[model samples]
Target: MKLFQDKVAIVTGGASGIGAAIVRDLADEGATVIIADFDEDGAIRLADELGRDRAAPFGVDVSDPQAVEATVAFAVAQFGGLHLAVNNAGIGAPATKLADIAIDDWHRVLGVDLHSVFYGLKYEIPAIIASGGGAIVNMASILGAVGWAGSAAYVTAKHALLGMTKTAALDYADQNIRINAVGPGFVTTPALEKTMTDDERSGLAALHALGRLARPEEVAALTSFLLSDRASFMTGTYYPVDGGYLAR
Candidate 1:
C-alpha cells in the first residue's frame, strides 16, 4: 500500500535495525526518505541501494541540537518539504544496577535516547507545520511502560519519551501535526545479537507471552501506520509493537 506516496520523511538511525526497516518500507511506498544516522557510510549505502531518487543519506549526530536542525534543513532542501519523521536513534546501557551505573553512562544513554528525540521534535515540528500537516513516531521501548533491573538510564529515558510524545501531540494537534511513541519488545537486532549468548537469547524470548522476539519489520509496520493518514485520529499515544511482552 503506497500510503506515503508523494510524501517526504526523515528517519534518524535509518541505517540499520528497526530504523533501516522503516526506511525501506517508506521508500517502497513512494515516500522520499532521508536516511539520517551517525553512521554516514551505512546511510549512504542504504540510500544507494534503495535508489537515490527514493532516498537520500544525511549524516546527523542526533544528540547535537545543531546537527538535528541541519538534518531538518537537508530534508527540506532535498525534498521540497517535510511531512513525516521517526526519531528512532537510541543507545543501550550496560547491565548494571542503578547505584552501580556511572554518571557518565547515564548521561550518554539519555543523551542519545531521550535528548535526541526532543531535538528532533524541536526542529521537525516547524518543518512539518510548513508542509501543512504530518506525523512523527518516537522510538520508545517496552521499558517505557515498565521498569527493568540494571537499566536505570534506558528505562528513565523511555519513560520520559512517553510524556514528551503526549505533550508534543497536544501542542501541535491544532496545527495539523500528530506526535506519538512506539514501544518495541526485544528484537533480534545486530546490537542485541552481539550481547546475547544463544541460551541468553532463548531465555529472553520466553519472557514475552508470545514466546518470541519482534522483527524489525514488525515494528516498522506500526511506525508506518502511525505516520500515515490512516491513523489520523491517533495521537499522544504509545503503541507497543511488542510480541505480547507487556501482557505478561
Candidate 2:
C-alpha cells in the first residue's frame, strides 16, 4: 500500500467514475494526488474527502494544451514534483452510425479522447523527466482495439491512442518514462448507467466472458499498479483489463 509513499500523482477526470476510482486508489497507496477535472466541484469535494493535505484539485480541460500545461505545473507546485499521471478525461461520441456522424462529432471525440493524450504528454513528459522519470497511464477502451458499430468517432479516437502510446514509449524508453493504457470493458459508472436503457444495461453484463461488468475500483487497482514501481517491467503495452471481453 505504501508503494507510492512520498510520490506525487495527477489524475485527469478525477471527479467521478473510473477517474475518481484511480484517484482514491493512488491516495490509498500513500501518494500525494492531484484531482484534475473540468468538474470543479467534484474535484474539490474528492480532494477534501481524501484529505486536503494529500490531495489537491485543479480544474482543467484536457483538450486544451494550455490548460494541460497549467495542470501539470500545478501538480509540481503543490506536491514538489509530479511522478505519475493518469490521463483519463474523455468524452463519448454522439450515438450515431458512421454515415450519420457529423464532422463536428468526429472533431469533438478526437479532441477529448485522442488529442488530450497528446496534450498531457506534451507537458507531463518534461515534468516527469525532470523528476527523474515516472509512469503514465492513458485511459483507452476495448473499443480502442476493436470495432464498435454506430461509434465511428469513438472507435477512431480510441484506436489512435494505441499508436500514440506505442510511439511515445519507443521515443522515451531510455528515459524511464513508461507510458501505457488500460482498455476496459463495459463498466457500470454513473454516466454509463444513466445513458443505457434498462435492457441495454442488463444485456451488457453478458458481453464479457465473466458475465458481469467491471467495477470502477477494479480498473483503479490496475491503474495504480501501472503507475508504480511494482509495474516497473511494463511499458508501451495496452492491457486489456476487460474480463476477457476481447476473447469474444
Candidate 3:
C-alpha cells in the first residue's frame, strides 16, 4: 500500500467530500499529504487524525492566486518536494435554467469550479517542474462531457476544465508532468446527501444507470490511481466514474 512512498501531494478542498477521501487514500498509501482548504478547522482535524508528521493542514482559497501560491509553497517547504496535486476543491451551483439563473451565481460557481483550476496550475506546475516533474488530477464532473437543464454554469465550468486539462497535458507531456481530469457521476457524498430529502435522494439514485449513487471512496480510488505511476499513460483524458449515467 505504500505505492506513494517518498512522494508528497497537495489536495485542495481536502476538508470534506471527495477531497477528504483523497487525502485519506493518499496518506494511507504512504504519501505525505497537505490538506489545503478554506475549512481550516476541518483540515486541521483531519491532519490530527492522520498524524501531524505525515499530513499537514493549510487554509487555502483556491480562487485566490496568492493564497494558492502560498499553499503550494508551504507544501513544498514542508515535504521538500512535490510529486502530485489534486485540484479537487469546488462548489456546487443550483439547478436552475440559464434564463432564470442569477448572473452573480454564474460568476461565483465558475470562479470556484473553473478559474481555481487555472490558479492551481499557475502555481503548482512550475514547482512540480522545478522538482523534476509530477502528476496532477483535476476534478471535473460527468457534466464536463455533457450538459443538463438548469446547470448551465456548473456544466460550462466543468466542460471548460476538460478543455484546459487537455491543453495542459499536451503542454507538459514531454516534461514528465502528466495532467488529467476526473469526471465523476453521482457520487454520494455528504454535500450531495445533505441537500436531498428522502424522496429526492431516491429520485436521484434512480437517475443513475446503476440505480444508486457512488461512494466518495470509490472516486478516491480513481484519484489515487491517477496520481500514481500506474496511470502514466492516461493524461489528457476525462475518465468518467459515473454509473453509465451518460449512456442513458
Q: Candidate 2, residues 150-221: lDDT per residue as tens digits?
A: 988888888999999989988998999999999999998989888988789779888999988999999998
Q: Which stretches in model 1 have alpha-carbon errors above 4 Å?
A: none
Predicted structure 1, TM vs. truth = 0.98
Worst 10 residues of 2 by lDDT: 93-102
Of candidates 2 and 1, the better by lDDT: 1
Better candidate number, 1 or 3, judged by TM-score: 1
RMSD of 2: 1.0
- Candidate 2: deviation at residue 132, Å? 0.9
How does candidate 3 fare on TM-score?
0.97
| Residue-wise C-alpha lDDT for candidate 1, range 47-116, written one tens digit per residue | 9999999999999998999999999999999789999999999999779999999988989999999999
Evaluate model 1: give its lDDT. 0.95
lDDT of each: 0.95, 0.91, 0.91
Model 3 ranges with Cα > 4 A deviation: none
lDDT tens per residue, model 3, 64-129: 889999998998887898889999999987789898989899988998899999999988898999
For residue 156, what is the lDDT in candidate 1? 98
